[model samples]
Target: MGLLLKEVEVLVVGGGNAGFSAAISAAESGAKRVMLIDACPEHWAGGNSYFTAGAFRTVYHGLDGLLPIVNNVDKAMVKKIDMKAYTADDFTQDIHRICSGRSDPELSQILVHESNAAVKWLAKHGVRFQLPFNRQAYEVDGRFKFWGGLSLKTQDGGKGLIEDLRRAANTLGIHVVFSTAAKRLGVDARIGSVRSVFVQTADGIEQEIRATAVILAAGGFEANSRMRAQYLGPNWDLAKVRGTPYNTGTCLEMAIRDASAKQAGNWSGCHSVAWDAHAPPHEGDRLISNEFTKSGYPLGLMVNTEGDRFVDEGVDLRNYTYAIFGKAILAQPGHTAFQVWDSQMIPWLRDEEYREGRVERIIASSLSGLAQKCAKHGLTNPGKFVETIAEYNEAAVAFQRENPSKKWDPGVRDGLSTQSKTKRLSLAKSNWAVPLIKGPFMAVKVTCGVTFTFGGLAVDPKTAGVISSTSNSVIPGLYCAGEMLGGLFYGNYPGGSGLTSGSVFGRRAGKAAAAASKTWNEDIQLLSRL
Candidate 1:
């Protein structure tokens, strides 16, 4: 027998935003004690939430709507900002549009309804809020205009959000253990109810932690290449992870085996994006993990290693199309692609992920010169690459003469979607299609990076209980949240919905699990008497 730990009323696995939210909500709901565990070491405890930009999607009626959920900002700052209303319909439509209409309607309803509540809850706890200055706004006549429903961000980036969650958890007296991995999830022999968790402690001791209920808030299996190869097929093993390496899907696997967890959603699908090809395999370094990810695909054109365009670069706004573009890159030879842009579109480029004139880049003065630079950087058929850009530019010019065009604007609509400015090409650049003229161009290489698996165990919408497909019944005393619980998203997801889904479901899961724990205890007592 290994070490036996004291029992707790609720046990939450994972220490990221979802985990912290569940633990805090459970404690507030009167769980006698709540124990939260993280597989990573102390400093790296936030999981994927730490590695993100920390944008949240909430429905708001312009600036006045934000006033209820937003705080900690100066009145002068608020007065200067102009925002557009992002109603529930807009949020719902956007979700289904990107998800290809496969997102669970029940879960989507919860996400949209409680979106504001989730933001306000975290803000009430410990998180600070400010209008996202850099990512969500553009300067208009010297004043900042905020667009997108994703205007409010944590005081800092992803790091600050998780830090605030951790601070709140500590203040509420929730017990958190880092560097602890769950080895087993114990279920009742006869009742088929989860009761305890067995964990490998940081010090190498196997500890049995008895709890009234367990919430699998850990995350998806994005970091496990073997699992990726198994679910997403052969070439996916080559995909880079955009977040934590510790999210190896241990808790999800253990629950599936020990309990009859019904898997749902797209097993082969995930939320992937074009990340820096030079970034490390598992995102080990924090300094460069998120910073090096270039999101300026709209400002230029993407060419595969074969020096050919795979998809229409301007088919949609970067916000709407970026998540799905990584797979196109993955499909390319060598699982790589390059983005090329010229001086004409320089001002519209993002300032976040790159240092101007730095990082790995091939700069040139002419189309052929750029092709030569591409050849040096391991691209094949450099001439074809230059030809593609020239063709694209010619089409852009022709389209502009025939159709009305709008200058690319960002702030008024939080970087709203762009429309085709030129005649539709075979792969038409729909929006923000600027001709790549005036040389002094550059290219940065990239590839597919998986963020989270879009598939996991299905949960009951009302109670957050794992729903058994075998019997269509609840797995008693077992609950789930975060990436481990599925049926919310399918092939693709809108920007900023992942974090919001986690928080909304995490809150519900914790409250439901705590209440169910009491029911389980009473059932046991009644059975003993019988």
Candidate 2:
């Protein structure tokens, strides 16, 4: 028999942003005893939220509305900034368009509508917010122009985000146990309600903790190679994990097996990106967390080992296209691709990712020389690589000559395309097209990094209660949030939307779970009198 621990009013599993959000929200919503557990050690606490850039997409009324919450901007600097209000309609359309209208309509609406309130609530809890100046804005015409519908980020990115959340959780007196893995859910057979959780500590001591309500925000199965191969299909097991190695879908599987949880969303789909080919395979680097991301492909071109351009790199803004491009690269020969850019675009690349010591850079003075250098890396046909660049340059020059009025602008979709009436390349760049005339080109090798799996347990939109697969009804004491609660995203995700979705549903689940705990106490009291 396992050791039985003290009962708690609310129990949260997972220590990422969503778990912290649920734990903190539960404490604030009148839950007296709240406890959180994480499988990872103390140092590996934040799960995937620690590897993000910390950008949050929220609906705001232009610069005026955001000025209050953001900490980086001031009265003087705000004068030169160009920002537009992101409305609910715009947010809704972006999710629908990016997911190809497959996102759950109710979940999408809740995410968009509650985004601002969620951010504000996080701020109230001491999580700092700032404008993502370095990542989201580009200085054009001596003024900072922000695009991609993302304005706020944590001050020091994901590291600071986790630190703030930990501080807030501590302040609320919420107990957190690290290196404790939840083994299974203890369900009451009478009503099929979750009553306790069986967990094992690092020292191999097993214990059962009774709880009034249990919230599962433990995350998806991206880090579990077996689950990835089983659910996400062939070669998915080979994909590098972009986050914590501890999120192996243990809680997700436990809930499904023990409580008959219904699963939903794109099982084969996930959020992936072009990552440094030399990065670690199983986990993210704490010091260089998100910098392993190679998102500057939109400013350049990507070619496979066959030395052929496989994707139209400039199909959309980096925020809109970066996630899916990793899958495109993974599908290429050798599961790798190279992003190439000339001297003109080199200065425009984000320094955190393209800086000299950050990534392995291949440099050469001419296209042939660049291709030859890439051959040493992985390029199989250097001659074809040179020919591809020559054709693209020719089409770019022709399009510019025919349409001289259209100028290349990286801030928006300037429509400096490589397609024209007289001349058209087989794969034309849709925007920010410019001839690579300057010498000294640069390239970087990249592969796929899976962020999180899209498939997860189906839950009620209002309360985030886990829906039973058998009875098709809500489990009395089972709730889910964050990536564990899916159907909000499908094929592709809008940048910064994951964090917002986590916060929104995490808060809802926390509040609802707290209320359920109160009801459980009242019922217990009535049964005692009987």
Candidate 3:
């Protein structure tokens, strides 16, 4: 017995950042009824945005204009990094570079142009931000920095933003259902359009939801190892190590199983593998710190089972991490890299609880404690570890002494500190240094934990509908945005672009769906009357 599901003007499947925007945008655009259905099993509390250091990259905002040096160095460092330096030519070039020519140019253009307004819209929705400051080069412009505009991650602020959006949806009479997970897209075979969606509620009651349009913003599958191996290659270990727990690639299965869908760009998946061995459940210090220069934290040398410092530890984070990941792929057992840091980094670790996101720290009082931490984590012998630390320290001391006036970037600078503050402590006084190094040491195992899967469904910008590559026509009533839509990221993702792209495309999709709803309502109502 088939149940005649209740109908809505628009159906958004997911409750994270993107889905929230999609439902809100649809209601704001005059949709008679908008419904956002999410499993939110525990709560969509920690998706990519929560774990991620929230950033959005766009070209028109003038971030590129401010720090051309950072822009130039970024270009020099990585040839394929997407550079949307506000110039149409540069933006297009970056898009092509990142996409590797596997994207719809028209859709890419629309994303670039609308990003600025998308950010502003977030602010309008009560997602307040810190005062903007100039950082490195921005997405398209040089003015967009991490501080440009971002809501503080307060319980009131973060939850309040979502509540405000939900309230707005309620005022417009949009249906917002919690604990409802979209099982799959219901496609009408007779007309070849999205008819409804299958949902499973908290009590395990399976229900159907009929809609005029289905916007699939259910996120990607970074947590699924089988999918990771399928898309990323045979060697890729898709561990549930990082990113969101709900992102098990269920959405990707929905797309692949459907015969009508066409997959799109695979963004820069070949980046670093981020795994936190000391992460939660069993471990206390859940800080999976990265040894990247851009991460703004000092990193000691990273070694494989062979105990060799492979790449330049002081290079740009992406460059160093990419190199390490490559080495990790070849290393014994593969996908595991040992991060060796001294007690000097303890301050950063202790203060981590107050900070948001992943923070891992392991304490030890003696050499035996250090060895035990390594042994417990399945690390190789700590014998070479001591030698590696000493060599690096010696090199750092020499480098800092020779380069006194150079106010160097933290990541690129040799691990030695010539800064007046660090100089006062001196390597002799530091516990992690050679003579005093008999005490505490820490190491974390890393694999590739992701913020969101960069890949997603393909769509046309003009209509916000899934496009058929063979026919070049819109897949009627099937739309996507946020991490669910692919090709917005070309090569390297600009910091804030992920959230910004979600907002931009979500609004565009909402407006289009609202306009299309009129025809849908009349047809459905006629069918009901009959």
Candidate 4:
């Protein structure tokens, strides 16, 4: 069965972090009858956020500044930790640096300047950020030090993030319609604005929900195979998806068709990771989606099926470089790569990789034994594998001998050279290239798993209004945010910027829509009649 609301003051599409933020902001801004519509059913309704660690990258003044975000942390305990403050300049520089200065200037600027404010807003609305777990911090001399410009993790990770956002929406009495998919948007030609959307209900009935304004925060088109093949180029459809299957970009398509929107950002660029090769094609099991990611590549060596090393795994931190490596793996012969680690490196693997006993890994006590194990699983013969390891080990030994005093620093590249050795690899391992001489080596196979798409309808930065390509102006009564609003990132992206961007722009778009729709009553009576 379907139910139609005669006239909604605002219609925010999607139900993930962005959509929830938009609805909460609209209702807070005094918009009446604000409703959020999502295509997903209630249980699996947080979109991609449901499967994330909810790491938010922001600017803070060391430990004192971090106190606000990590409210649950005891001040006494925080004082014992050595925290480095990431300045606004540091944040922006990283945004530019990681993407090779290809990210949009204005969007990156806003994200840097307004990131703190956005986090504060989320906190005000009951989003609690807990002290980071094992990933971004390390203890030295009995004092914990934070690294990689990341210090806070959401209290409940992604699920908790969604719950807190939705709880805030409910407290504000924001209406949410689940299991309803937006089919098409109806535009008033005279005003050049979206007035209503035709939605298909859960029971397959068509319903129209007229609204004063529409905020599209329904995420990107990464889930649609044909769209992925068309926009992301050939073989992209073959890559595994790491998040929701519901984000087909239908809202983005409709917005572009009606709003004269220009596409922006690197459409082919995405936040991809080196997920487990044996994992399902899509987000099948929550446990697999959560713990299946094998991110210990920088700590060891990864080789394609040709038994050859390709990328310099230690050029940058895993978070900064992980997004692009998946594409490299996708380009490999079998679209697969193996992350090989020795006994010494095994202790350094991420906690999830160690805790999750389900990972199908090859284990052995010696290089030759490990080679035999890998050969059994189709990574080429044992001889070639051992030869490759010996060469890699020689380079690592030479580098170690040259820099005898150097220590393993995960925060920045230590310039650990794999070039000065007797055998030089074609593609260099610039940093963290130590000898894999320890016994009991282990390896995990990985393939490309895309997180989200980077391209969508371009918008005005200040108002987050969907921009008109023809007039170079905002489309009245139309707004877009979250992953659907592009022009923010390119070439590559910062590790934890997705959720922060979504919240910042989603809140802005919501408040903008509420203020813009204050006088929009022209079609209320007409929409009511229909």
Give me the candidate number with maximum lDDT: 2
- Per TM-score, the best of the predicted structures is 2
Determine which window of 10 residues in candidate 2 has minimal summed lDDT. 1-10
* Model 1 worst lDDT window (10 residues): 411-420
Candidate 3 steric clashes: 34
lDDT tens digits by residue: candidate 2, 179-264: 88999999999999999999999899888989999999999999999999998888888889999998898888999999999998
What is candidate 1's lDDT per residue for 1-530, written digit by digit as tens? 11224698899989888888898989888787888987788877789988888888887778776676555557887777777888899899988888889989998998998998898888889887767777777677777776556777777767888889988988888888887888988989788888899888777989888898899988899999999999988799999999889988888788888887998888888888888887888764576556666778877789887778888776655667777888888999999999988887656566766566335777789878988887877789888888888888887777666654445554332221223344446776665667888878878888898888888889998878898767778988888888987888878887888888888989998898788777767888999999
The TM-scores, one per candidate, come to 0.93, 0.98, 0.71, 0.95
| Candidate 3: residue 332 lDDT (0-100) | 40
| Order of candidate numbers by TM-score, starting with the best | 2, 4, 1, 3
What's model 4's lDDT at 149? Answer: 88
lDDT for 101 in candidate 3 is 69
The better-scoring model by lDDT among 1 and 3 is 1
* lDDT comparing candidate 1 with the true structure: 0.80
Q: Write the per-residue lDDT of candidate 4 for residues 1-530, one digit (tens) a residue.
A: 12346578889999889888888888888898888889988867788887778888888887788686676678578677777898999999999898788878998899898888988899999999976757777665677767788877788678789989988988887788789999888888887777898899889999888888899999898788888889888888888888888888888887777667777888878778888888788563555455666788888999877688888888887778877888889888778988898988888787776444768878899988887788777687567778887898888787777778877765567777688745577777888887898978898888898888999888888878888887878888888888998887785787888889988999999999998777665455568889
TM-score for candidate 2, please give it.
Answer: 0.98
Residue 395 in model 1: lDDT = 78
Error of 3 at 220 (Å): 0.8
Model 4 Cα displacement at 29 (Å)? 1.0
Q: What TM-score does candidate 1 get on C-alpha atoms?
A: 0.93
